[model samples]
Target: MSKSDFGLFGLGVMGKSLSRNLAQKGFKISLFNRHVDEVEVDVAKNFKAEYQELKNALAFDNVEEFVASLASPRKIMLMVNAGKTIDIVIDNLLPYLSENDIIIDGGNSNYKKTKERFDYLQTKGIQFIGTGVSGGEEGALKGPSIMPSGTKEAYNNVSQFLETIAARDKNNLPCCTYIGPEGSGQFIKMVHNGIEYVEMQLLAEVATILKHKGKNPNEIAETLDSFKDDANSYLLEITADIFRKKEGDSWLVNLILDKAGNKGTGNWATITSAELGVPNTLIASALFSRYISFYKEHRVQFHKEYIKKSVSRLNLADDDLLKAYQFVRIINHYQGFKLIQEASEKFNWNLNLSEIARIWTNGCIIRSSLMEELVSIFKETNTILIHSKISKMIIDCKPSIKRVVSDCVLSDVTTPALSEALQFFNGITTQHSSANIIQAQRDYFGAHKYQRIDDASGKFYHTNWV
Candidate 1:
């Protein structure tokens, strides 16, 4: 058999899809899965048979044979679970791999772990690329937004395949790019997932507010559809579709359970934010909202016990709701980009914020028309707050967001994400805040010291008062 251009391990959904995508791109790929049992072997065989028409595709039941089938300076991609599974696969492949061979982890592994693996692999003279492949199952099969970070040489070696398999932008440019070195790609993907969580939560809040205002799912769907061109996001498009979905005689969305499930990435984002002291309040609130929903039983009992009178519904204009939604969406992107900016500084990643926006312009869940504006803004200036156009938009939309949030509160509707967005906006824009009192209190209790308005920079003072 001819040497395979790439090797893909883990015959799971993502792995299989990516393998097929690569093969369709005319690259010879060797597919392998850990064959601990007959069932596993059968899966690999079935996968190969399913894509047998792709003359460039091959499957191997043995790990050694899989590695051997690859061409020199072999490129192997692991699409298995994050954490220990990635390490286990790397260990298994280490014996068969030679110097300069590249191992790419296409999982949602922690950036810290990716960095550790990069260092460990470097000692063995092997290259490691911690890549972020977004767009889910269908995106993996067709094309994904790829973020790769490793040595420049390793990136150069696989750039052709990665670019070819990535989704294209409006100008027909690939959505794949070299993010930075040492787990930068995974870090960016984590932030991407974080932003996604907040965006979804905000959309759900909008839906809830619409429902409270006596709009049926169909009505809400229609209302949301109007924003599709303005927001122009995949999430919004899918949300509009979700509102229109019917199961039997009822809307499927309403029939669904209230509990939201998480896959750890949201929590990771919050944790990283806290660790970095970046104030990712919007994303954190969204994460907490999920936790709140998990207490469905308690909520039900509490509402029955304490809630007797119903609040009067406030009539809100569809235009107001749309404006508020757009405001929150912008804040969501701001918070995510702010987190990324902080991470890049702390990690010395020197990440290109504009390129990050460009890559997310398509294929990813958060892909939005707003990203085009962001790409331009970041390219012109990294100072997000100082951008005159964006700052003006925020100022102009603040009133609408405030009105919507206040009405939601009066209606007894929870809009944690929206509320946090307003708070975030206030926090960043406020020139004078009550933090001075906080510092005074800390000084009174613990002698932590406080800086006076007239004091020289970096000078701290403490006073005793009885």
Candidate 2:
């Protein structure tokens, strides 16, 4: 074989699954792990096509040997941690890599870090790609979608193989594609995670409310399962099954900690959004949700002292609650999309927001059937939400949205992330001015620091009545 279309540099959960997946696709696969025996017996038993797959091309004790073993323009996908580990992997592999070799960082890497790595490697004619892969271990093992961004040359060398391995989106586009130049793939992935946070939080709030109102989680799941077409997302589809599960009086998710932990991608999303002057309150909300989750000890104190004020009657019937919950999730989705749309514009991402939806449709964590609608909208409009059919539908459904948001606020049912995110989205969309004036007043009187574009900087200015 030509020592092409086959190489991976990690044997962890994702790497192991992906390597086997590649072999399953009839690729001339060459597997490598730092640990020699890590993939030996496993591949022998599971990957039947690899009796000699690694015999001539097997594990390498070091990068020096692995690169020498491969043909020119070697393609190596790295499935490792970010930060220092990436540096270490790069340093070790650089000696063996010739010019034009491709190194992909497939972990949940910060786009800035990927950009830095890409820039550094490019000077040596080495190509570094920041590829975002989703579908988890199973996705990796069978066919996961891949978001790759780097030099077009690098993509040219790899597209055939990538297409062969990726899951297909609608219109038969490869689940894998070049997102954009430089860090866009990773940047997009970061935003994807951030949105995921909001969606999860909104769903969590619904589950909490359902349980509090004496409805079984299974019943909640059953109701969600009934939704079809664009209304159903992969997460909701899975959650439906989860809700139907019963262990005594609670679901398994109920037993899990409410606080979410992150490896800093969402943090990166929030930071980048700030730097680009893009508002990413949904992503920011996700990060805050994680922070709030960390207050386990503080929660105990709060439950004793603060929860007394969480009183309200939400005696809506299960059917009505289900209707409201689905509508809220739609609001949540649109709001997240609105944040994405606004951020892309403000950051000059010039990004195809609808195409972004298409990319995430099958491979990433946020993939859902609703993206089909979004993708169709993008095909017809240059302007993003203002004139899309979906936007029209959302307008028509504004009554439900308003009712749900108002009900949540009036009853104090504690949908802080979803409700506030919706309010933020709605305010921006309809040009809500009261809050902006209020904020200006607070800043003008309190810190006295925000700048007005129409006025000069450095010196402060304010008015009580003007």
Candidate 3:
């Protein structure tokens, strides 16, 4: 038999979809999954048996056989659980891997951990890549956005294979790029997830407001579909479809639990933003919203104890609602990219923001017309807030967001993410903020120093108060 060109470890949903994608792309690949006595026996065998595309695939229950099946300078991707399991898999593969062999971690892993693994593998004469694969199961089977980072040479070795299986933009370019060294790929993925959280919350808020206005799920779906031109996105498309889904006689979404679940990437991104000194308030508020959702009993109890305010229909036009949604989404992207920019500077990654935006134009959860616009915008400016086109768009949408926030407040609707997005934008754009008063208060309480507006000398001074 001919030697396989690639190997993949793990047989989970993502792993299986990606394997099928590679196989469909015409690469001979070796598949391996640990046999759990009666639990997961012959996963690789079953996968190959199930998919016609993987008919020529080599299925191995043994690690030695799996490694031997691959060609020299092997390319093996790990799609298993993140954290300690990754280390265990790497250790298991280390014995069989030769110098210059590449190992790609495609799980949602911490960037710091990816960096440590990269350094550790380098010492062993092996190459390591921390890859961010997005677009979920369907995208994985067809195409997904692929962010790969490592040494340039290591990335070059696998670029063809990765690009071949990645989603294509409208211009037919693959949504895959060689990100900067270390774990920058994973860092970008983490921030992408953080932005996703805020986007989801914004949609939920819109749905809540529309529901209060007597719009049924089907009507709400129609309204969402109307925003398909400029605001077209995978999440938006899927959300519209979700609203249209029915459970026999009732809308399925209404029957489902209100609480949302997360897999840690949002938390990681929020904490990382704080560590990097970037204001990702929209993302933070979204995370907190999820946390708040977990206390169903407490919320119910509070609802009973608190004075009930009448919730009325939101008095807003669809055009204005669209403007508000777009405004907040722009802010969300700004916060996410700002965190990425700060981390890039701090870590000396020399990341190409344009390239990052370009790759995100397709096969990613956050891909939209705005992201496509950002590809060109990032080439001229690092921040979207200052971009001429983005600035005009923000200026035009500002009034709508202000109106929406006010309406939500009057209607007794909660919009933490939207409200924070507006507040964050206002706070940053203000030439003279209330922060001076904060500095003065800090000085009064703890003897911290404050700088005066007239102090061109850039010296800090303490002032005594009664």
- On a 0 to 1 TM-score scale, where does candidate 1 land against the true structure? 0.97
Which model scores highest in lDDT? Answer: 3
The digit string of per-residue lDDT tens for model 2 on 264-352 reads 87788778778766666667776787788899899889789866775465555555544544545555556556655665566465667
lDDT of 3 by residue, 202-297 (tens): 999988878887899999999999989868888899899999999899999999987788999999998998898888899889999999999889
Query: Model 3 off-target regions past 4 Å?
Result: 307-309
Write the residue-wise lDDT of candidate 1 on 206-308 in tens digits. Answer: 8888888888999999988998866768988899999999999999998889999998889999999999998889888999999999999999999999878
Model 2 stretches with alpha carbons more than 4 Å out: 1-4, 36-57, 246-250, 309-313, 317-350, 382-384, 430-432, 435-466
- What shift in Å separates residue 380 of candidate 1 from its native position after superposition? 1.4
List the pairs of residues colliding in candidate 2. 218-244, 259-293
From the highest TM-score down, the ranking of the candidates is: 3, 1, 2
Measured on C-alpha atoms, candidate 1 has an lDDT of 0.89
| TM-score of each model, paired residue for residue | 0.97, 0.84, 0.98
Top candidate (TM-score): 3
